[model samples]
Target chain A: MTDWQAFFIALLQGATELFPVSSLGHAVVVPALLHWAFRQADPSFVPFLTLLHLGTATALVILYWRDWLGIVKGFVRGAVRGRIEAENERLAMLLLAGTIPGGLIGFLLERPLKALFATPRVAALFLILNGAILLTAEALRRRSERRDLSREEQEQQFKSAQQITFKAAFVTGGAQALALLPGISRSGVTICGGLLAGLRHQEAARFSFLLATPIIAAAGLLEVPQLFSQRGPLALYAAAAVVAGLAAYISARFLIRYFRAGRLDPYGWYCAAFGLLALILLR
Target chain B: METRGNPALAGVVAALGALFVIISALYAFGAVSFATSDPGAAHHYKHALVALAIAVACLVAANVVRPKAA
Candidate 1:
């Protein structure tokens, strides 16, 4: 990939990785739609992709450092006492419950899934499907909201992300596995899961972001050694990573504020429209 | 008031985590083969990393489930 191409791809990764859109889908379809020559099968490609992921992961870590610190401290305290009593400790376990399913599934199925669905045409189709998933989630959430709630139930509707049950967290985390498909969005599905679990949009988004950090970081860190072993434009790759990190940081900051009152409708429409346009053009 | 813990479950979970750690170590040291016919450095690294993650999760879960006496 040229420097400019790498830069653009990095920016895309940073933004979409956080946005409720599918980054992998865009990575596949965008280049093909634009007729860029880079293939996913290129030897250096995986390592480069991992570097970009690492950059995004770092940005997330930095953004949520306070929360992470609390989680770690709470986890350690709980571990030492052999009891998860604190909110932070419970949140830590909730995240772990959520992480396991997706991590295992991703580890086992990522290659096969990518091989089967990594094509631009396939990605475009899934991108459209992703939009459908988002819209369905929104519709369901709206439906749930319209139902009259008892006084106690009304309090439950606004439960903080950290207050969600372990089962809910696990299900939400499991939803992330769907993102292995090129066009399925990790954040999108997790947020949907959170919403279904009774969190408000902002809280669901928060949980989704927290749940994402570990998996993304793991995906990137696992490939760190390869980043050095593979040759060609190391400096450029590093620069791209930095750019991706900055982009991701910005996107994350923006989304946290946006989700306070924003719904996923705009993103849903964008994904559907963009995917359709790409399908027609690529054909 | 007193709180109780699930010792048996915690032990099982910890044991499972230990098994994964052992398996990861074996794979890293070439004692066991991974999915690939001739697993290269990348495959090994990936397996080891994944194993480590599973193990950590298991250990943490075990810790959380087994409460210390108060």
Candidate 2:
């Protein structure tokens, strides 16, 4: 691929990765639609994609540095003392629970699923289904009393990520599991699961962002060595990674604010329309 | 100003998605090509007619599902 193509892919990776839309779906469909030849079977493809994800994960870490600091401190202190801090223990465990399903599923089924639905046509179909998932989730009447909260109150409730039950995390993680599909989005499913579990949108969004960091890191770490072994342009890829990071960071900021009072319905429309176009044109 | 924010912004996004569909269609049908080295390069997209129709329906559904301001 050309430098500009790599840059464009990185930009899309950064933005869509966080936007509760399927970045994987975009990764598949966009190239096919543009008639850009990307060999998914090529050994280098996953590494290239992982580098872009590293950029995304970096953005998440930077954005939530304070939260990460607390989670780490609390985790380390508890590990040494054998008595986890009440809030940190709960939050950390919930994140662990939320990570489990996707991790297991990716480990076992990723190869098979990619073999079956990695094609742009199949990914596009799943993308439309993803739209339906977002809309249906949004349409469910919120059960939490936190509905109609102002921005500041919402922030307070966000701290209640500590209060998330293990069941909630498991279910949300189950949603993340579906993201092994090319068009299924990890953040979209987790956030939808979060909302259904009675967390407000911002809360769900925050947790989704948190949930993404480890998964992205693990995937990137596995493939980054391959990137160096390959003949790809290091400077161009680095520039693309930076572009991806910036795009993800900005998109996350916008989304955090938007979810304050905004609905996921617009994204639903977006996914449906784009997926339709994909289904029509792509094989 | 209708699209500076909020409900208007939502519609604008939907519209832009539709525009992309249109552009994609143009590319698929050889109405346009970005093959700079060979401008006349022809690209074939599967099911061009069906794609065109879906592109139109996408625009409709996008607007139909748009949330009203307020």
- Among all candidates shown, the one with the greatest lDDT: 1
Report how far residue A189 has shifted in candidate 2, in Å.
0.2
Candidate 1 structure quality by residue, lDDT tens digits, A1-283: 7889999999999999989999999999999988898876566697788889999999999999999999888778766766777888878778888997788678668777887889999999999999999999988877766468653454356678877877788788988989999999999999889888888777888789899999999888878878777777878888999999999999988988887767888999999999899899988
TM-score of each: 0.90, 0.75
Q: Which regions in candidate 1 have their CA more than 4 angstroms from the true location?
A: A146-157, B1-19, B31-43, B66-70
Clashing pairs in 2: none
Model 2 lDDT tens row, A1-283 = 9988989999999999999789989988898899987755457675677678788889889999998887777655543443334676556557755765566466446666777788888888898899999999987733343668774574355434666766788689767878989888889998888887777788889899988888887677656766866877777777888899999999999999998767788888889999998898864
Which consecutive 10 residues in model 1 chain B have the weakest lDDT in total? B34-43
lDDT agreement with native, every candidate = 0.84, 0.73
Top candidate when judged by TM-score against the true structure: 1
TM-score of chain A of 1: 0.94
Error of model 2, residue A190, in angstroms: 0.2
